[model samples]
Target: MTERAADGTGVRGRRKRPTMLDVAREAGVALRTVSRVVNEDPTVGSHLVSRVQAAISALDYVPDERARQLRRGVTGTIGAAVRNLTDAHPVLGAIDHNAREAGLTVLAMSTEDEEAREREVVTSMCRRRVDGIIIEPISSNHQYLSAEVESGLPVVAVDRPLSGLEADTVLSDNAAGIGTAFRHLVLHGHRRIAYIGDHERIFTGRERAAAFRACVAAHGGPLDGMVHPGAVEPDRVVAALQTALGGPEPATALIAGNAATSIEVLRHLGAEAGRLAIVGFDDFLLADILRPALTVIAQDDAAIGRTAIELLLARGADPTHPVRTVTLPVTLVPRGSGELPPA
Candidate 1:
């Protein structure tokens, strides 16, 4: 006779799970010997190891990895707190690959770009006793992590730095990339270039917008009605685009601050996009296939990931060392769109 599930969902009852003691009884060996064999102790003789293995196979027994890891005082897992899970996150993939190569598992959780969610996810990771943490910060104040940091938890910030806490960080060179985009547009005979980007409250947004201002000042271009730094919303972006292109001295070219802004600008322009020269910061999926493929300042996603893992491991190996910040370089990928002449 078979037992039905407690909820009467038609799922069959499970067999009595086998335990370590059952394995020992089956092998006719002491419980301690079975424990040693399961733990891979080299001192166990060959004959005993073979007998224990046969018994384990016959009973279909599985060792409790969580209990074993607890006894060893390390979980062999790392936690990654990132912005979202729905997007194509190449950096996260690289981090996972590198962590696996180092014999560690990655427990990834999305923060949904919310400070409260970030705190909840990170706190849960801490409760699980993860060996280290890699975070893409969304919080304006990370002082809540001070206690954990002081207690020797290894934390590495990626893409952006933690606001109030000092930790190892990996970042792309934002200012330099902005400069490259501005110069690229200038080289193509676009003196009246406009800039549209993320909100100034964001770290990258602030850096890129400041860099654009500096470029315009140095080149003697009119700054008025040209630089638009605000929320990346449809209405805001369209208004900014109109202001840049509507005036008598309308911009001949545009530099988009980020990938989302670039897409927004293009979506607003439609078939008219071909008339204006454009350069965007940060590449995105399917960008290369757009008509007049997007020219972009691309961050080195793989390097960012590899370097993040390296920093994480180094932090774990020597928690007393001074915190380090590594800023990787960005590259300019010129496609058809950025090369268009002023309309």
Candidate 2:
């Protein structure tokens, strides 16, 4: 049973893929010369390139993408494992831009803030043999990646650190952001401030919550019924709000942890939102158009993204380099809401 491919390769059912060695043999050139020619290395003489091209044409030698990548010691592509892709993420866009400028492609996957999903997405990227990985770690136990890390796979954590694993991290200075938010409210005459954000189990949530508490202690303000760190659900937020506003000493200011928390707090507050001094962490689109305009402790998305890519590339370049944790600065965007005096 004899057959032929389009290039006239003899085959029965499936034709064997041609290797670079075959190209070298057909070209009567050294393997390294063929490699240089295939990679378009300018150092190769014109005659050598012509010979290689002619041989490639004759043997129908199609170089395997993975083989070329292996020979070059890089895949020229990175994997981005972020929280989710369903929403608009400026950080992801920045990462893509930076990666493109470095002559690399990006493959993005969603973790959805689930530990299992995060592991699956990241491990899948590793199996695919990506050059490096940029991860928004939702899993608390990243010891699973120790083998890959030891193997010199550059893993950079964005938005949070990988627990049980010391990897390059890019954070948004969460404590500083929270402290700034609190001061902004205090300057506006908010004596009693309340905070509701993501669960304390998460690193950002823990950092922000601790910073808020520190602010209260420093200002000699009451702490009772002022801090709420739990799930960002309507029922939980509503209950926390009721507790914060109903006690003997009601909170005059509110600080929502993340964008989702801010939206939920606003939705629950309804008309009452106008009377409360509010500050949120993490800025999103149309944050300015809200009725009272949302004041927020905005993470530097561009800086964070750029830093994450930088860390990933650096780790790839020098695996023995000490893992660094970059804490980029955050900003307090003052709008009408956070500037309001105590109600």
Candidate 3:
């Protein structure tokens, strides 16, 4: 039996385990080259690969999964945290499919737009040691993310900005889309326009709000009565629209912040939908089926998801690379509603 330590611990002191460095030293190659071979990086030459393999066998060294994860600061798994999984957001599906094709597993979680829940979800992913993360941030706590990034983990913000953290991001051009929507309404002689959107704390929401304000001012429209933010839920958006349309001079047209909001606004209008013109940010399934097909500033959600994963994979493989932001353009689809005349 192995002798116990002086402290009366049952376990005896063993020789320190041989690490990748020891293998690299014996293999006569740089630490990075050994890491490349271990990771199956194609850049490693055959001669170095053979040497590393020979050294690993001679030393009888067993690769430590936990140590490897710690050394790379990655778990070979990617995490995606969204607002909801059942929202039928095409982007979620795209993310899952693309990640699988890239030889990376995706662990998706939903925060339901709650800050506390969001924090919990992030913490859980960290505990699992995900290789990287792509998130739709819910709040302005950018400092928390900065700490995570500082820990050598690669993070990318999708559909939003990480308030204060310097990280890679992939998002739609919200300002351009909003500007396009506003201009479309104005071109149709919509002087009284109402904008309904999500909470301002979200990066996309803020950008949409800013663009709406700027466009209204640039087009010489009334910015005061034409702006309405913080109406994300269906019931809230319905109520907001009812109030906006009930005013002394109701809006001639409405601009929805997203597809979900458009659905709510349309439901609120019901049979009166034909009476008011509408332009929305995202395209929905039944948009073309409505009495007057909905006009929308459509974004490629799937592409957004794919691009985000690509960015994360690139960065994860090369931590020393500079962070990048990839912005995809939005297109405005014209339909009967967008061409409606003022009330």
Best by TM-score: 2
Model 3, C-alpha of 42: deviation from truth (Å): 11
Query: Could you arrange the candidates by lDDT from highest to lowest?
Result: 1, 2, 3
Q: What is the TM-score of each candidate against the true structure?
A: 0.78, 0.79, 0.78
The collision pairs in model 2 are none
lDDT (Cα, tens digit) per residue for candidate 1, span 12-57:
2254567778999999998778877876779999999999999999
Best by lDDT: 1
C-alpha RMSD between model 1 and the true structure: 11.2
The RMSD (Cα, Å) of candidate 3 is 7.2
Looking at model 1, residue 153 earns an lDDT score of 73
Error of 2 at 111 (Å): 1.3
> Using alpha carbons, what is the TM-score of model 3?
0.78
Candidate lDDT (C-alpha), each: 0.85, 0.85, 0.79
